[model samples]
Target: MDEIQLTAAAEGMPNFNRRKALAVTGSGLAATIAAMVAPRNAAAAVVVNEAPVTRVNNLAWALARAMDDWMVDLGVDGVPDIWKAHVYPYSQRKHPVAFESLDRSPSPSARVAELEAAFHAEWAALRAIEPALNAAELRYMEIKGSRPVMGEMTPEEADRLRSTTVADLAKLPPNRASVEHAEAMRAYNKADAAARRKTGYGKLDRAYMKATHRTSDVANALLRHPAMTLEDLASKVRVHRVWEYDGEDFNFIMDDIARVAGKAGAS
Candidate 1:
């Protein structure tokens, strides 16, 4: 992609899909908070000892890795540049899209298994902090909702709650922290792209067109999935064999491919 188009594409897309953040439900609130506030340099340490112990971690990682590997298996070279530019550094929701795409020749299912295992291990360690996490959450909630009255509650309860909340807020969970770090990185990229776009990168519309066209093609292929009829089969082949060759048309092609693939399975 040319500098101008690259700048525009980067700026046009969101850094991370906030929708993914909705995964933080009920009890997972602690996990979410932890993930957001934890320190970067301490991820490994925290992963080993402080990460949230939830089944969702493994599930999320497995699916993420599988999706990424599947994209690579379909043959788009080197992590979709758009994802790298706009998604990867902003949140775990999108990071796997690029990393597993670049991984060499692993079957999508296999990659999924690998990531699932890794997540399991990490979560096993993370769950250990549940007690502290819950305590902190309760404390933080109390403090934020209403300031503790001097004599409304026992001095010990007040002290414990305040101290625990302070600690929790001070050190966010590892996964949560990673997400925030990625967000900051994405913000930086956005700023840089905006600056570049303002500066004369505006001329690279052709490159953007080229990339988006191929992306659209992949999308079309995915849409044509489940090829039951000869017509559908032909369309799939045409899209996959012909248009798929052009990266600019990839998105459309993939869409058709997915549609056909889905239909085929149903049949």
Candidate 2:
């Protein structure tokens, strides 16, 4: 695969299909986050610790970024010029032992594992409320006469669409919402937002944001990481193999992101 796109690569494009912020129902994305976050072992091994942890990932991002910057300054032969421009310091900075341990510790370090656990907890909380919000969006036109709050989606339908976005749900229906529906939607959304917030999803949102930033930091940092050659970078960021050596496209594609989006978010 020659220069295949790093679907979620963070140079220019940002959100890495945050809906799937690390893992799916429980697969694939762990590696994606791992690739960028924990480059050494990269979450390949099973995590045994489930202690509540925080800031570990942010620190990990710090170290990986430091490593990448270090390599960039070394003027590693294969490093991309834009990547050199991309790193902030153009030289490695000091890392705390805790942060450096993110790379040095065993694969899926206890802290990393705890971070993932926290992520899943938050991800689940957000998902629990989204279907109702989504159903409301899909059924927006009938709100005044429709169900009181939710869009009336069945568990089966919600399950099928668990991964679909509000926009995706909107696309499935042919109902033409009148301009008045926008006002209705506004009220409904206000109530919905308040109700969702009442469920304490704000904390969840903040936690996921931290994890994702760290993960994306890892992805961007990899471009500067010493072990990651351009070839390695090419392989890690790809959605999948297309034609053999078809060519690289490091740009992030929204469509690809949606395809892999799982039940989570960075929003």
Candidate 3:
């Protein structure tokens, strides 16, 4: 739906989708929110005109995304009590009594109490299933950004590195530290040194590049700074791909991630 239509539907007004919609269970409410959380965006394409844009534009976009997330959290399909107050008592749809009675002439202290209670009850229920909710959110992001649904560091690489480093350390003479400990220390040193060498760098760099081509970093980068430009994101490092990074695009993404990570650290 268009943004205007989506907004209208969210405001308790009926829309085409609502006409065709089926009654959803409370159990599936979280999934329904997750499905609607992600805003529709066009595919990655270079803007040829490259008009001058201000930082405000980025902030605005970020706020828009945040609102979308908020809407999802409040049960887009079910409607949270907070919104229901303003929705119900005026239509066939249900509304929170607190909202409907907001302008009541008598002291509203009683209505306020009821509103608070209902709010807490809903909030508690949400918190109870928050972990699953978060997982669903991550899955939605990955799907939206065309990123890898599952990622991992390979055990084979870890084992091979361990073995090679251990072999190198075995030649070291023992000191006050036990032979086993000394050998382990040497192995670790060897591993660290090897990782600093060209091969290790190449492996990490290549993986970042490959992941970028698939927009695997999109979900991560956008989540942090929704306003990131295509060029701005071209410069970061990633190490979560089957193949190593070797292309110009990969190099850029790696640099971007590295720069952002550094800034985050300093901050």
Of the candidates shown, which would achieve the greatest TM-score relative to the real structure?
A: 2
TM-score result, candidate 1: 0.19
Order of candidates by lDDT, top first?
Answer: 1, 2, 3
| C-alpha positional error of residue 199 in candidate 3 after TM-score superposition, expressed in Å | 30
Tens digits of per-residue lDDT for model 1, 1-267: 111111111111211122233455676765655554354225436556534545346645655665454444434454432212222333444222222222233222332233322332222222323323333444444333221222244466456556666547656343443566566667666664554454423234334335445444443434333333334433333234322344554565556567657777898
Q: RMSD of candidate 2 to the true fold?
A: 18.9
95-189 per-residue lDDT for model 2 (tens digits): 11111111221233233333332332333333343333333323332233332332355565556567668877876542233344656777776
TM-score of each: 0.19, 0.26, 0.17
RMSD, one per candidate, in order: 21.7, 18.9, 23.8
* Every candidate's lDDT: 0.39, 0.36, 0.35
lDDT tens digits, residue span 1-267, model 3: 001110111221111121122356454754654443332111113333345364335534654564454444433264421222222232564322222212122222332333323433332232333333333434443433221222333576455445666657666443322445556666665654454342344344344345333333432332233213332332111111212344554454556567757777787
Give lDDT: candidate 3, residue 68. 51
Q: Report the candidate with higher TM-score, 1 versus 3.
A: 1
